[model samples]
Target: MSQFALLGQRRFAPFFWTQALAAFNDNAFRCALLVLVAFQLGLDDHAAAIYTNLAPALFILPFFLFSASAGQLAEKIEKTRIIRWVKWFEIAAMVIAAVGFVMHHVSLLLVVLFMMGLHSTVFGPIKYAILPQALKSAELVGGNGLVEMGTQLAILLGMIVGTTTMGAAEIGPWLAACITIGVAVVGYLACRAIPAAPATAPELKFNPNTFGETARVIRITHADRAVWNAVLGISWFWFFGTVLIAQLPIYTRETLGGDNTVYTLVLTLFTIGSGIGALACEKLSGKRVEIGLVPLGAFGLTAFGVDLYFARHGVAPVRGLGWLGFLRGAGSWRIALDLMLIGAFAGLYVVPLFAFVQARAPREKLSRIIAGNNIMNAVLIVAAAGFGLGMGALGFSAAEIFFAAALLNILVAGYIFTLVPEFILHFFTWTLANTLYRVRADGLRHIPEEGPALLVCNHVSFVDPLLLMANLRRPARFVMYYRIFNIPLLKFLFKTAKAIPIAGQKEDPAVLQQAWDAVDAALADGELVCIFPEGALTRDGAIAPFRPGVEKILARRPVPVVPMALRGLWGSMWSRRDSALGRARLPRRFRARVELVVDAPVSPEHARAAALEARVRELRGDMA
Candidate 1:
């Protein structure tokens, strides 16, 4: 099903709207307040600057102070109940904001702003932690994509609505107040329809000491290296985003020489682009939590970011140009394209990392991990603010700052990828599979979502592992023939993937023995291991007899065995079909239609080698 179909489901739609409405109100209220301070109140430039600067700090402060406690609360209490309470809290804040808006009470409005921040702080952990419970494993990516797209669009609309309404002279603040309050009430109503999501760790102790619990929660988040890095990747996205967004107003005014309409236009472009990219993740990832897109996103951020600088580094000669006039100017389209693609890539970068954290973190500790992620995000946002301020102080142009951030992205991405080669490996695999074949995977749900499993597949070509790796939702260690494992160009991929290189007893006894030990160990540790039962690639379009290697491994470690078959790969690039016919292999079937058919896993005791070979043959059928 398309991700959009999720909008019709009770499990997802209500939560989606509740969160989207909250996002709308948050941005709406903030934008309205800024308009009041900057234009309506008649504040001097210095005073306006103080309120503008203090606003973000006050809003972000709750994340640092209460995220840990909020995470615990999410874990300790039923989530839907807390969500109801949070919505009511929002209504109260909006009520206060209503009076503040009419009375021109800046202090009261700021207090409401802080209260909204606190609302978000309390909701942060539940936002992510609840997904794993509400969604099927296959639905996680699509669900996250929907949430992301909704949030981006909601934020954009909120900003436009808030700014436009508040820009009116006399009735503006009243209008803003009514709208915010109405949205808050609607959000509360939407959240009421959210089905119950029981606490993951109801028995867990609730630590009231903020400092001690904060450190402890962070420690839990960092317990897994991969999970922690994913969190860091998320934080870096915030840092990059904060810098880019913080500069856009100045960039629009000074660099683009445009008025507020142009600013709105640019904001719309970025937001719409991000929403498109967010919605695209479900299709691009094949509904899996594919992190390969993260690198692709990083590359786009840098490439277009640098190109953006060269597109228009100098200030435009014309001043006070409206959006239309700006768009008609020289090199304007390029700048617009740069901004849009940057937002698009930002969407691709973040959605998967969020899904990855949700899928990877322990269920009991997931809320705390999300809380810790919030804390890190808050710190980075503050740092981004400082970086933007420091660059402005050093007299760097907005375009120059964009250039610097793009360049810095290369370093940050390289560092992160270096620390986790799996990201690069997945990128390579995902690229190869998507480029070489249009893969249709079926019966994949039969593979256990968690725990140990032995996958036995009919090996057809050299790229079989890559295809399977790309399609499998869960990571699996592949066992390949020793010679294929050592192929010069492919050696790094195999080694990084931790593929076990196995040899026949006659060829290399040590290698064969070592492979057996590794297979058993991997299964014992609750990992998935896939092996070719044929032991070598088929020379013709036929299955070889099943070897006893699989049976031997099962005897040692009796994990569930899944039989998988790859079809339409016999004549593909790396297969032996052409070589057997004494002809040069060519790209005859580039982007060939391929199928990966998996059968229900057989219990270890009944998973005989011959039966599995028979099952795989039936699955492959006459397709080859």
Candidate 2:
């Protein structure tokens, strides 16, 4: 089923709406305040600028101060209770905001903004930490996609409504107040429908010190390099977004020389593109948490950003054109497409990273880790603002700033991917496996989600390890024949993947011994290890004799043994079937059909090498 089916389910729908509405309410309040400060506050330009700019910082400040505490609370208390309380706090904040609006009290309204920020900080952990508990592993990416799409659209709507309502001449403040309060109440009602989310760590004592807790949570987030990089990736996205969004209004008015309508049109295109891209994650990823998409997104961001800079490079100013008129203007369509694609790529870039962080973080500390992510995000957002201001101070135009940000994106992406090669590695493996053949994997659920297991598959071809690695959800450490393991172009990947290489006893006794030692160590560390029971590739398209190396490994540490087989690879280019440079193997069947068939795992005590060989042969059947 498509991920949209989640929107209709009780388990997800209400929480989704509650979160989306909260986003809507936040934008509504913030935009309303900005409108008031700009048009009605009657302050000097300097003072007005201070309030307008400082408003966002006030909102973000809470994330820096209270996110650590909020994360811990989500871990200690049932999440639904927190959601309900947060909703109540939202209502209270809105009420205070209403009085601020009616009485023209800027100070009261600023406090209201800070309270709303506090509300969001408390909800941030619950928002992400709840997903892993609610959805299956396969659904994590799609679920996040839907949430992201909803949030993007909600923010758009709230910004439009908040500005429209508050900017009206008659009863504007009261209308904004009513709208905010109504959304808050409806959000609370939605929270009632959210199912109970039990505490992930109930026994953990509270850390009353925010600074110490912040340090501790950040340490936990840093414990895993991949997760920490994922957090950085997320933070970079916020920085990217904040810079672009902050520039859009000025870009619209100063560069395009268009009025409010044109500004709204560009923002709409960007936000809608983001929502569409978010929804596309499910189909693009084939329902997996595919981090490779992050690279694709980064590429798009850089490419389109440069294109956008050029699209509007030297346009002369035009006055008060509607969105349609702007479209009719020279180079406008290209500019429009550029903005939309940037937003879409932003969606592609961020959704999977969020899902990966959710999937990989330890359950007990998931909330705290999310809090760490928030702190990082806040810091990056501040940096983005400073960067943009620094660029503007250098007298760069908005288009130049866009170009600079785009170029900076390359450096940022390069740094992150370098820090963690798994993304690029996954990109390579995903591309190669998807390109070479159509692989069908059966009984993948037979592999355990956690802990050590021994996978025994009949050796098929030189690329069997790659196929298995791509298809398996949990990572596997492969034990391969030393020659194939050292294949020149692939040797680097093998070592990076930590594959164990071995040779026949006569060829290399030391290598064989090291292979066994590695297998035992992997299992002891609770990692999956896969070995070919038939140690050599079939010479005549038949299963080779079972090797006793597997039996030896299992003897050292008894673990679950899963038997599997690769089918339809006998005549592939990588296979040894018709060995005249393998040209005879290359006809008609290019991108051939291949299958990795897995069977139920057996206990190590019952899993002899011969038994696994027989099982794999049975699974392979007549495919060869």
Candidate 3:
């Protein structure tokens, strides 16, 4: 089914709108308060800074303190009913905000902000946990993409509305209050339509001790390396986003010299870029839960962040120009563009990480895992604030700080990717294959997560192995021709992947021996080893008769042999028939929808070359 079909279904749409509207209201109220404290109350510069920073701290504080309790609530109760109660609380919080605004009471407003944060903290686990319950596994990525896109756009609109309404000449406070209350009401109504989501862990007990429960939750999450890594990835995104958003006002005033226009512009560009990047996940991921996009996002974040620093440094500050004039200004435009792209890349970076966590976490404990993620996000955001403060104390200009942040991003991203090589490896292969041609896969579940498995497939493209490698949940060692393994541009990739290179006996006896030994060692270590039994690209666009070498390899180890097929690769550049000079050439962009169909695993005793070949051919069907 298509991704958007989820939106039309009863299970997802109401909750999606409810969450989006709540996000919108939260930002609108926060921005309105910031404007009031900055301009209407006649606060000093330092006081305004404290208020702005303190607001986020106060809001996020609840997650750290109450997330454990919230997680238990989500796991133990019906999610739809819990969400209904959360929405009612949102209404109560908004009512308080409206009162505070009308009274021009800053203290009361701060209290309301904290209350709102607490509301969100209680809703956090349910927000993510409900998705897995409501949507199918395949729909997770697209559903997350839509949620992320809607969220960023909502944040942008809320900030625009809040700042605009707060700065109005007359009745600004009243107008802000009315809009905030109205949006809250709409959000509550949306929540009312959410379909029932049964409790994942009905017997889960409540734990009130914050730190103890937090530690327990972390311990449980750590049992699954992939899920824990994804949680850390999500936390890092919050760190990056917090730092960027925190600097915008400074970036606007000091760098661009526009009052509030530049502030809104930067925020809008970043948020919109994020939205675009988020939506692009569906296309880039090929409608799968592609965690590879996480590393891709990190790369873009650092790349664009570095460029933004340089771009801003090169720009001569525009003294009096408004937002439009600043955009038209000579170097300033580049900085603007850089900010937008950085945000876009960030969107690309974070959405899939969230989906990966949702899809991989144990079903019963998903809510607690999400709660743990929220707690970590809160911690990272707080750390980001401190980092910014430290940078400022060292007498760094905002531009210099931006550069420092960009450099730091490289280190952090590198560290995360090192801890999780799958992300970087997946990014590499996905980028290579997607850029070269459309890829499709089938029967991927036949590839065992552990133990020795020989994957025999028809070779149709130079990148076919990489595509298969990228999609598999576990790392795989591929046996390839010596020359392709030595290709200069792809040399580092092959080395990093530890791909085994082989040659025919007449060409290179030592290389063939090395290849065989490597395959044996990999299988002995209980790792998956994939071999293109065809040994070369199909010259006639048909499965070459299976070679006896596969039979020989299996005789030694007697491991499971998974029969697989690749379709729609015959016309690819590497296909023997497609080459103009009897060599591989680049194919058209996204033209073919390739598929990898994996048949049931065949035991070594029963596996025969002809039998495996015929089974694969049947799965490949008329596509070949």
Model 1 misplaced regions, further than 4 Å = 581-584
**Decoy 1 TM-score against native:** 0.98
Task: Give TM-scores for every candidate, taking all chains together and pairing residue i with residue i.
Answer: 0.98, 0.96, 0.83
**In candidate 2, what are the lDDT values of residues 1-624, reduced to their tens digit?**
789888898889999999999999999999999999999878889999999889989999999999999999999999999999999999999999999988889999999999999999999999999999888777888999999999999999999999999999979999999999999999999999999999999998999899999999999999999999999999999999999999888888878878899989999999999998888877777677788789989999999999999888654467677788899888899999999999999999999899989978999999999999999999999999999999999988888899999999999999999999888877777677888888888888798878999999887688888888777877789988899789998887888778999888999999989988899999999999998777778768999889787888888999999998999988777777787553546635557788988999999899987788788889999997
Model 2 pairs in collision: none
The residue-by-residue lDDT of candidate 1 on 284-341, one tens digit each, is: 9999989989899899889999998999888778789999999999899999999999
Clashing pairs in 1: none
Q: For model 3, how does the per-residue alpha-carbon lDDT over 181-203 read when each residue is reduced to its tens digit?
A: 89988988888889889998998
Cα lDDT of all candidates, in order? 0.93, 0.90, 0.83
Clashes of each: 0, 0, 5
**In model 3, which residue pairs have backbone atoms overlapping below 3 Å?**
273-344, 440-594, 440-595, 441-596, 442-596
Q: Which residue segments of model 3 deviate by more than 4 Å?
A: 44-50, 314-318, 440-456, 459-463, 471-563, 568-612, 621-624
lDDT winner:
1
Arranged by TM-score with the best first, the candidates are 1, 2, 3
